[model samples]
Structure formats: C-alpha cells, structure tokens
Target chain A: MIKKRFILNFPPDSGDKPFSYHLVKDYDIRINILKAEVYPGKRGSLLLELQGKKDNIEKGVEYLNKQNIICESLDKRIHFKEEKCIDCGNCTAVCFAGSLTMNRDSWKLEFDKEKCVVCELCIPACPLHLFEIDFR
Target chain B: MQKTKTYEEINLKLKSGKAVILTAEEVAKMALECSPEDILEKVDVVTTATFGAMCSSGAIINFGHASPPIRMEKIRLNGVPCYEGLAAVDSYIGATACDPDNPSYGGAHVIQDLLEGKDVLLEAWGKGTDCYPRKHIRTKINISTINEFTLFNPRNAYQNYNVAVNSTKKMIHTYMGTLLPNLRNATYSTSGELSPLLNDPGFRTIGLGTRIFLGGTQGFVVWPGTQFNTSKPKNEYGIPVSNSATIAVMGNLKEMSPEYLQAAYYDKYGVSLFVGIGIPIPILDVEMARRVSVNNSQIETSVLDYGTEGTPKLGQVTYSELQSGTIKIGGQKIRTAPVSSLSKARKIAGELKKWLQNGDFEITKPVQMFPKNTSLKSLKETEADND
Candidate 1:
C-alpha cells in the first residue's frame, strides 16, 4: 500500500462539495483528514493523508482536480531550521507521529517528513520556535 | 599502595600532550569491560558535559564611559532592560529579561547577537548629578567596543532534574516543555551519565576556581550555585535522585562562541539561555573511576505531575528508560522526551577532550572546596516560631 499527503485548496464556490466522501467512494482510496477549513461560499483548504494502491491514490488526486480543487503535495510543508535548533528533543514529546525524533546513534534531532502528518505539533513544541509552516 | 593522581600531575601530562583523556560516556562504557583500577591507570581525565536551558544566567557588561561620563542609573540593551544599580557603566543583563514589545527577544538573545559580532542599540538614562553631568545617551555597541563581557551564571549544569508530565485534561506549557494532557508523555533535561556533577557526586574534584569549558572557551567555577543543595538523599549509586548540587560559573563572554551559547523561547513561558558547560574530572583514585563509570540505567529521577499546583511526585524512572523513548507509569506506557541536547553534550565533551589532548587546556587545583553539607532552605512569608 502507498501513502500520500496533500493540501487541497478548494475554490470559493466549491467549498460545499464533499471531497472526502467522493474520493473514498469513487477512487477506493482511504482518507485521513489531518486538517480542514471548509465553509460554503468561501475559499477553503484541507491538509489530508491518503492511502491505498498507488493507482487509486493518483486517481483520487485526479478526482480532486476535476472538482476545481487545486491539490498540492505536502512534501516540504514544514521547515526544520537546523541552524536555529539546539537539537533539544522537546518537540518529539508532542509529535506523536514519530516525525521528530533523536537519532539514537548520533543523539541529534532528526526530522522524517515522510512520517510527519503536518500535525503542526512541533511548531509550539520547539523551545527555539524553529519550525515553520511552508504552504507555498 | 593505591594508585592516585593530582592536578599538578594531570597538568604536567596535559602540557606535554600525553594526558590520556576519555569522555564520560566512553569511560562509563569502558568500566563495563575493565576493572576500576585498570581504567583509572589508563585514563587521566574524564570530560563531562551538558547543554540545556539555564535560566539563572546573565552577562555583565561594562559599556565604557560616555562622552561626558554619566553615572548611568538605567540601562537597556536592544530595548531589553538590564539591572542598573552597579557602577556607572557596568550593568547585568539577565537571560530572562524580555523586551517590552516582544517577549521572544531577550537579554540572552542580545548576548548571543553581540557574540556574533552584531551591533546592539544601547540606551541609558542618568539622574543629573554634580560628579556626573550627562543625562541620556543612546549608541550602537558590539563585543569589541565593550570593556568587559563576562558570562556569570548563578546556576548551570544541574546534577539531576525531575521528569515533568501533565496529569490534567488540558495541555500545559512549562519550562520543562509542552506537556500533553493525561500524562501522555514525560520530558527531562539532563545528559545522564555525561553530566559534570553526576561524575563527581562527592564534590571531590569540581570546586571553586576549577577550570572548565564554558561556551566553547575556558572558564572557572566561581562558587557554589544559588540552590547548592548537596544534602539531598543519594541513591544506591551515591548519585542524587533529584535536583541536587549546582555550580556557579563565569567566563569571558567575548571569548565565547555562539555554538555554545543560545537563546531559547518557550510557548507560554519566557526567554532562557541554553549554556554549554563541560568539566574534566581527573582520575584521582580507583573510587573516582567507579563514580565516573555510572551509566544511565543506574541514574534515577522522579516524574512529577505538572498539572497540579504543588507538583506532586508520581513515580521514578532511569535515564536509560527515558532515552529508550518510552516509559511505564502505573502500567500505562508513556512516551519520553528530553529538553537537553545529548548530541550537543557529546560534542562539548569531545571538544573538551580535544582541548586536553592538544595541550590547549590544563587542570586547575580548586582554590577552595565546597562544603559537603548544604541545606536547601525554604522561604516563608512569616518568621518561624522559635519557642
């Protein structure tokens, strides 16, 4: 099974459409909506995770595109500023997804974006305030 | 006869580039394979290090005299207020003192910025007097322009600290870290076996005037720290089970590096300074070897409930369990995290070892040894009944 994350930006008019219901129904893909901000007549965005066969996941993105929703991959959604970070593993306490962790061998802080679900837990968890959201 | 060494002997070897040094972690690992006597003979010094938030820290700066020589009564560095009761141009900028407009930027940030060679806006006000006429002055200053930049910390490198956890339904922000609700995770802030005081639990080697690695440069232990409580109960390994002894250190802030000094900001808490400190313990005897060899599994600390008002103790866990990433509290598995940087602690220990191996740093016999019994007295609103 393959997993993918994306931030779906819905146009102002299509905010009422049920993107999760349609993606799961038509594309046979599993959806985990990490974050959502949908309101009728207002442009909204969603930070979500999709899982299933690779083809089904791609079809889900296509389905989102067909509905006037601009789907963007969430590869570098969070920035880990290494220079500012003291490598204090405080962020890992709130990051339940195991994305922020200490490399046991090197004892340094390591961020695995693949494991991060964009929970934004590390933003406030960092004492240095080094983590930032990069939607652009 | 028992094999022993002294500060002079260690310094002689250090100066000749023949001193055998190992990090506290390395010596701890070596103790598992070799006997204490063998290890003591081979290793002359064991460097212990820690890099963590130390709030009772500040810098003393003498901003030279003004044009007309004002007895400055008030001072602010980059808009952050500093203590102004000292000499005319001398003042102390505490780490936690924040800017009125921005809480994140503080005196610690100002210190690090100055060390980075960046200019800081200095503003001062003085009461017009006969001896000192000038009233007000504002100017840009850097490290080179200042007279003395000394990092004098009231407390740093805690011997041990409590593990913080939240027991309430809502999340809490503390100096320890952000704690999730219902005791979901635990946060600790120490380097375990690689800590300075832990290796020298008896205060035999670390004392006033002892040379140390402070902010990437050599410094000295000035006095026993503010809450220097050496009277705390010890565990089976002779190490304190809770926050115990502490040391007051000072160094030339101008000679320090930004890598070893940093400013920290907590979510709801305030500003603090992350200080890098390392102390090398000379292997004086076989007993000293045994103390330096204590490992994480043997070092224990209490988990306290931060959700409550008094911070009641919940349970005890070892650093090995905390470093394992998960610990059990009352049969429930709770995730464990650290506020201290073990990697940076290791780097400091390695750096101190390099200083010794290269003959750049030498051991100093403490001018005075700390007293063994120190009561951590509590303050009261009213006087105690003596009757």
Candidate 2:
C-alpha cells in the first residue's frame, strides 16, 4: 500500500534500454514505462510508474542507485525574466511545445506553463541571463 | 576437431529439447538454418559476448533472409560460450529444472533468447534483476546544460534512450553478481563449517544487503547527460547521441537498503541455503509462467451478452464508476475499475506490484488479466446495437 516516486534525470544522449530492462529484472519491480515524448525542438521526458511493497520498493531504489540512476528534484524557480527577454524568438525556435510564442505587435515573449513538462530546454536558449531554475 | 555432424543435425537437436554444446563456429553455422524456437529447445545454456547485439533495439529477426539467422548466434555467460538464440526456451527449462547447485542465471540469457517468451519468467521474477553492476565516471567539471537545442533525429533519439537503459542494466547485473558474493565470503561472521556457513540465512541476508547498497549507488549514473557527452567521445557506442537530452526520474531508496532486504530474503529462503536450494526451480519458473500468460492473452475474438435495457446502462455505470475510481466487483466495492484501456493497464500494473509483495514468490497463476476478450466483446455488442 505504500508508494514512492523519484525522477531520474539523464544526461543528453543516454538511452532507456539498460535502465528499463534492469528495473524490471534486478529489483523485480514492474514499471509503467512511458514513451519518451520530445517537444518539437526541446528535451524529452520519460515517465515511469513504479509500485511495490515498502521494502521491495526500497530494494528497487537501492538497485537503481547501485546502477547509478540517481534521483532528480526539479527546481521551478529557474525561469525567464520578462524585462531582460529580447523576444528574439530564439527560445521560441528551440521550444518543442511552442511554450514560448512571439507577441503580434511588439517583439515580446509569452510563456505557456501547461505545455511544459519541465524539460528546461528554453532556460539556456535565451542569450541573456533571463532564465533561472527555482530548485525549491 | 573430429568429423562433426551437419548443421541440420544440430538444428534438429535444438528443436527437440536435446541439449547440445557447440563451438562458436558451429553455432554460427547452425544459426543460419535454425529457428529461434529450434535454438531455444536444444540449448540449455549459451555463452557469448555477442549478446550485446541481440539485446539492442535495432536487432531484427533474420529467419535466414538477412546476412545470417540472428537467433543462431551464441552469447557468453560468465566467461562461458552460450547460445542466445535459445535463451528464452532454455530459461524456461532451466527455471523448471534449476537446482540450488544452479540458480537461474536470473534467466538473463533465456529472457533475451525467447524474446517475448522471456516475459514468462519475468512476470514471475516480480520485476528487477537479481544482480546489478555499478560504475562511477568522474567528470572533468560539472556542466549543467551541455546543449541549447534538441535533435529531431529519430535514430539519435532511439540510440540515446536505448544506450542509457542498457548501460544501467549491465552495470546493475555486473555489480550484484561480482561484488556481493565476494563481500559475503570475506565478511562472514560464522565460525562453523564454511560450506554450511554459505547456506546460513544470516549470510544470505548480508549478501542481499550488500547488493542493495551497491544498487543504490549505481543510480547516480542515470542522470547528468552533459557530463557523459563532454567526457566521453561522440563516436563511442556506449554514449548517448549528442543531440538528445534525457530527463531521468529515479525512485526513492529509503526502503530498499540491505538491512530491510535482508529480512525479505531471509523470509523467503529461511536460514538454510540447502533448503532454499532444494526449492523446486520448475514450478517457481518465472519465464515459463510469463510465456503462458502472454501467449494465452494474444488478440482473440469474443462475445458478451447484456439485456436490451441493461447494455447502455452498463456502459454508463462503468464510465461513471470508473471515473470515480471505484468498482462493484462480485458485489464488493473495489477501489478501482478498468474503464478504459489505459486505466485497465494501470490496474494491471497495480496488481503486479501487489503480487510481488504478497503473493507466493514461486511462479503461480498470473494475477493480471489481458483485456483482449473483454474489449472485443464490448466492441461487438456496441456495433450490433448501433446497427
């Protein structure tokens, strides 16, 4: 009845095979492996639903840890500042979900939170230090 | 060196459940003509390093059409040459016939050999590998974000994700197998007979604990792709493609440590390695059960009956109740219902977790049910009513 969740942040270019298969076999835990969905030109997200007993789940965690699948906590504070934004469309160009769009009249920017899976792709796209990740 | 029988003979033996060991050359030749099933039936164990290829996502079933039969290649296990083509089949046989003297190689080769057939053992194993290898790659410096853009290339995407997963699995398996046993033998506290000491539940608990710690530390490698790209060469097969970024979510490890796991392992094995060893491998065979479950659940037609007035009401009831996260199962109020395909899948996942923790560890009837018939029946009934 006990349930726990952890996010595993991968470096750019890592595959899902070794982690997925090992989770199933080594820890004896079945995971709902969500397909890695990539926004048009942004980083992707791989969602996994893992469930087991308190101890087994812990064992599964240990197993993942030993394999180097570290837990990731998102910092929502990292965001783009409005005034410093250039509205050059660079962030929009790299945005996979069109989460950032250009305003019609002025060269201004707009942000959509619903479309974001928190991949943090647009943070660095802005040339100016307009974005920051809020770890809290 | 002696005059050997034709590849056909070896293929025949593989198909008939007869165990025959062959060298690498013989396996390659036989693989050209043998079916995956043929290879599986005849080989109990296969050892080869070429296994990396078979486990890859790009691997295909040649069936004699492409260069050679992909299933016929041999895979190595613990420095021994083994056939991977028959891995799934052999795993089933091995699980059923495995003795304490020979623990299921966690059905590693068999799971790969049987392809989907390996699911038979996997479902029974209750998820996860018995052993996992851990590694640490110190980076030159911590680079938060490596690239500014994402690559739309499918090949790069697939490679990136696949390699990460594969590397993680390999590391876990290696560490569990290599380090735990050595650690236990070296740190054992008993002063009695060494052979009997090996069977003590206390020792096994310690071993499982060590494996858990190793597994927990192993999780660190799943994240921080920027380090991997900058530190490792782009041409390396192990590295993920440069263009893709991975968002890895790791599970909490507070409960999965060695001390807790020691208790679980002890509960299952008792204090005697001999008794644990005596436990029947076949009936507890994870591979065979997974196969039977998947095969029986393959797509099929079905029919359902509902009274003329009750049909629509049934749909409304299911929809409403399922949305509310409750169901009337055999008059008892169940907390969840399988209203949609996705929900059904989620439900099954829940049940699988339950089975792992509470059900007998030995292979038993599948606790989850495939929705093939239920969906088909409902669809047909709805169509008839519409017509």
DockQ for candidate 2, C-alpha atoms: 0.02
Per-candidate TM-score against the hidden true structure = 0.95, 0.16
| lDDT digits (tens) for residues B132-207 of candidate 1 | 8999999999999999999999988888999999999999999999999999989999999999999999989999
Model 2 chain B worst lDDT window (10 residues): B272-281
**Which runs of model 2 end up more than 4 angstroms from their true locations?**
A1-63, A74-90, A98-124, A127-136, B1-387
Clashing pairs in 1: none
Which digits, one per residue and each the tens of the lDDT, describe model 2 over residues B1-387? Answer: 222233334334444545343322233345457643554454322211100010111111111111211222333222222323432212111111123444432222222223222222111111122231112111111111111111110010011111000111111111101111111100001100101111111111111111111101111112222211222112211221121221111222221122111100011121110000000001112222111111101211111111122212211122223223333433444332110112111222233223222322222122221111111112336465575
Question: In candidate 1, what fraction of native interface contacts survive?
Answer: 0.88
Per-candidate interface C-alpha RMSD?
0.8, 24.6
